[model samples]
Target chain A: MKEKLYRAGDIFSRSVGLILFFILWEAAPRLGWVRSTYLAPPSRVFGALWLLALRGELARHALISLRRVMLGLLVSVAVGVVLGLFIGYFRRIDRILDLLFQAFRQMSAFALFPVFILLFGLGELSKTIIIFWASLWPVLLNTSSGVKNVDPVLIRSAKSMGASKAFIFINIIIPAAAPEIFTGIRLGGSYCVMAVVAAEMIGASSGLGYLVLYSEETFNVPEMYGGIVGLAILGIGLNWILHRAEKYFTSWKEV
Target chain B: MAKIQARGVNREFQIRNTLGRKERLKVLEGFDLDINEGEFLSLLGPSGCGKSTFLSILAGLDKYDGGDILVDGRQLQERSFSRGIVFQSYALLPWRTVIKNLEVGLEIRHIPKHERRRTARQYLELVGLAAFENQYPHQLSGGMKQRIAIARVLAYQPDLLLMDEPFAALDAQTRENLQIELLRIWETDKKTIVFVTHSIDEAILMSDRVAFMSARPGHIKEIIEIDLPRPRTEDIRNSAEFAKIRKNLWGMLQDEVLKVQSYGGYL
Candidate 1:
């Protein structure tokens, strides 16, 4: 009972700042401290959100953005993990590709957007490729380092037991490097959200990013804030799902 | 015939110096010994004396530049399921539960799942940790982890066991307890074991013979026969014979220890 009360108190304390900020936001417009047209109040923002939901427009755009992020993330994970494993396992491969990969990593994904547009055109494919490009580096680099840093003692122990090379690779190396791989995946996940939103803002007809940009252009400040809120929710939800997945897979790790 | 015969074993390491020049560092030279079948031998020496290196070679986890290691009258080629090794760090798969860790070797050998589970449980019981079969290695104490390590190797039923300072990291009391437990286990199975350690007391209490090793490049300084009676206990540590053996072994090791210390400790 005491612990439960303590937890309740903890939650209450943590949310106090958010509650105060919202109250201040609501009071500012009412008190005319700021023009309601220039900065929509929290009430107006939430009201705009409810209107968009009722029209089903919010869901439509959110689903499109969600789909793009998922596609890009999936493709990046597949290619990155496979390539990273090869690079990490073979010193020769690493030596051959290190300089090229390092150069590519140094270039900004946004700076290459025009090149992608020129090559693939301003379509779903280009947006996805942008997200994939942004996210792939983290997964690839982290996985390679993770595989490279696997405890030699573990490998030696497995070898001493007469474990075949394939068996060692599948059982010892993969599981041992999983924590790091998950870290890479989590970082890649956030990068996916960032890159997808930016890509949509730059060139796309639908998505939370496009909605935010379109609303702002039409002077619908309240709906723009609503789209911003929606994007925040999407980012948080994606991160939470990835966090849960990481916790599930790496449950063996000591707190 | 001896179970393992190391005839003039030699090993060297090439390391880059400050000037980026390759320099050969000899770790073992003319290291020779004969380990009789089912005999418990302790390779005892100071740190960096290459006793562990020799044991690694014996386990076929390492290669020697010049040597013939005969196992069962055949030249040792590579690692086989016939020899299992336990390490100082307990090297348990952190992701695997205790029982699953025990089953790793069995899995590698392609044993059936049911048989692997049974053997794992049996070894878990033998180590007196039946209740901890479901617990991960990180959850266990150092002593418990080492016990699990021992059980993991024993689960495979290897013909030979190679232990490199398996109990060195535990507290003194825990070390003594494990030493007694290990002896008890050895008494029942009598598997040929090459135990590596730097402790004089551990060497005398656990082995049929203590192979004293010199500093790098290491070779057998002397092979002292430990004629202590079987089924030894912690009380054996307090015995007069144990003290005599300890003193004698320490006297032999004193020069090597000082020699290493003079050279600015471990190389």
Candidate 2:
């Protein structure tokens, strides 16, 4: 009963903090302490959001952003896992590709945007490629590191039990490296969304980033605020969803 | 036929310092030993004694510069599906639940999924972890993780079991409990076991014969037989007979242990 009360008290305090934050935000605008032109009030942003929702523009933009993020992330995951397994398991391959991987990873995805644009044009291809590039390194590096860090004792144990190389890879290496790989996937997902937004902002016809830029240029301050709010919500939502998935996958792990 | 025989086993490791000075570290030097089928032998020595190196050679995970290991009348070059090892770390796959971890060896052998599940369940029950089959290794205590490891090896039905200080990482209480559990498993499995440990008490408790080794190019110094009765309980540690044998083994190891420490090595 004491434990129950403590937990309830903890949760209640957190809820109070959230309520206080909103109260402060609401007061700042009501008192006109901040310029309304530069920082549109949260109330005004919500009103613009409601208008976008009624016109269905919000859904359309969110769907476009979601599709791009998923496509780029899926490709990154596939290529990263395969390449990582190869580099992680084989000493020769790891040695051969180590420098190349390191150099490529050091180069930022944003810096390579121009190169991608030249290759794939300013269509969805270039935008998707930027996301793919940003997402790939984390997934690949994490997977390889995970595979490399598998316990030598486990390898010895598997060999003693007469498991073949293929068997050990499937049975031991993959499962042992799973937690790290999932961590890589989460990092990659975040990068994928961030990169897609940047790609859309730089050169794209439709996306939340493009919508934000278009509203800012047209001097639709409320619409711009609405776009920024939407992007923030999307990023938080994606992160939360992936975190839930990670939690589900690693449920067997002790907290 | 002898369960295992190592004739003139020599293992060498090459090391290069930062100055590019290359040197040879001979871990095992012309080591030789033999074990009968169904024997429980403990290789007892201090750390850096190469007892584990020797065991690794016997398990066919490491290649010797010379000599060969024969298991059941067949000379082997590398590990086959005939031996199973329990490492000191327990080495349970953290991502898998206890049952899934136990099923790894079976899964590797391409046993049907349902059969693997049944076999894993049986071994999990044997280890007294049937209720916690779905629990991950991180959720378990040290002793429980080691038990899952033992079950995983047993699931493979290997004729020869190689244990490299399997309980050395646990606390004293947990170690003693695991030693008792190990003996029980050995009795039920009826497979030949070659266990490596530094504890004289542990060597005497679990083995049919204790092979004491001297460190620094490790060599077997003596083999003492334990004529104690089966199904050993914790009370054995307090028994007169057990004390007598423990003293005898400790006497033989005293000089070696001193020799090991004087040479700047650990137990």
Candidate 3:
């Protein structure tokens, strides 16, 4: 019971700063310390969110952004994990492609926006490709390193049992590398959300990013803040889901 | 006929020196020994003596640049289910539960699930870890983990057991307990075992013969037979005969240890 109370106190203490920030935000505009026109108070922003929800605009934009992120993340995971396994397991393949991958990984997805738009014509495909490009490197690199670093003793132990190569790869190497691979996937997930928003901001007519940009351009500051709030919620929700998945998959690991 | 025979086995490692020049470091040279079926043998040596390397080669987990290791009249080229190895580190799969870890070898052999479970449970009982069947490796103590390693190997029913310092990482009490337990298990089946360790007392206590090794390009310098009666007990460590063998073995091992220390060969 004391432990429970202590945990409650801990959470309250942690939230103190956030509560103070919200109060100040609400107070600053009403007190005229900041212009209400430029900076919407928390109350006004939340009112704008309710209005957007009532009109179904919030859900529409969020769904579009979510779809793009999911699609891009899925594709990146497929390509990254499959290629990473091959590269990690085969020294020859790693030797041939590692330098090129390292070079490409250094280049940002946004910097390649012009090239993507030029080829894919600024549609859903380009937006998705941007997210995929942004997210691929973390998954690829982490997975390869994870696979490469699987304990040699484990492999030797398996081999001593007359385990075939396929059995060892599937049973030993993949499971051994799973924790690092999950880390990559989580990092890739955040990248997907960030890239999709940026991509939408750059060229799309829809999505939370476009909503925020379009509202700002129209001087709908409250709605813009609402869009920012919506994006934050989306990002947090995606992260929570990935966190739960990571926990489920790596439950065997010591906490 | 010998269960396993090694003839002039040679292994070399190409490692870079401090100056970044590649140099051939000889790990084992002209390593020859014959392990009789159902006999217990210990390869006792100092660190960097390549006894573990020779064990790995015998397990077929590593290759030798020269010479032959014949098992049952066939040349050992790769790992076979007939030869099981227990590593010092107790290389149990952390992702697997105790029961599942024991099932690994059987799984490789494509044994049926029911049979695998039965065999795994049987071995787990033998190692006195049946209660930990659901526990993962990381949750177990070092001694418990080694017991599980031995049980895992035994679950597969290998004809030859190759152990590389299996109890080296445990505490003295745990080590002694396991040594007694291992002998008990060995006595039941009498599987041909080639154990490796650097500890003189452990060597004298456990094996029928101790293959005392020399360091820096490791090879068996002498094979001393342990004539102490079985079933051996913990009190044997203090017995006059045990001390006599231990003293004789340590006298031979001291020179190799000094040679290695002087050469800075602890790799």
Best TM-score among the predictions, by candidate number: 3
Which regions of candidate 1 deviate over 4 angstroms? A1-4, B18-20, B262-266
Per-residue CA lDDT of model 3 for A1-255, tens digit only, reads 999999999999999999999999999999999999999999999999999999998999999999999999999999999989888999788888889999999999989999999999988899999999999999999899899999999999999999999999999999999999989999999999889878999878999999999999999999999999898898889989998998998899998
True contacts kept of each: 0.88, 0.84, 0.84
Task: Give the TM-score (0 to 1) of chain B in model 1.
Answer: 0.96
Worst 10 residues of 3 chain B by lDDT: B258-267
Q: If the candidates were sorted by their DockQ against the true structure, best first, what order would they fall in?
A: 1, 3, 2
Interface RMSD of each: 0.7, 1.7, 0.7
Cα-based lDDT at residue A17, candidate 1: 100
Q: Compared with the real two-chain complex, what DockQ does model 1 have?
A: 0.86
Q: Once superposed on the true structure, which residue ranges of model 2 sit more than 4 Å away at CA?
A: A1-32, B16-20, B229-241, B262-267
Q: First chain of model 2: TM-score?
A: 0.91
All candidates' chain B TM-scores are 0.96, 0.94, 0.97
Model 1, residue B153: distance off in Å is 0.3
Clashing pairs in 3: none
What TM-score fits each model?
0.97, 0.91, 0.97
Tens-digit per-residue lDDT, A1-255, candidate 1 = 999999999999999999999999888888999998878999999999999999999999999999999999999999999999889899789988888888887778888899999999999889999999988998998888889999999999999999999999999999988999989988999889988878989878999999999999999999999999898898889989999999999999999
Better of 1 and 3 by TM-score: 3
Instruction: Give per-residue CA lDDT, model 3, range B1-267, as digits (tens).
Output: 898889998999999988899999999999989889999999988888899999988888888999888889888868577989999998999999999999999999999999999999999999998999999999999999999999999999999899999998999999999999999999999999999998988888899999988896988899898999999999998999998888888788888888987886554
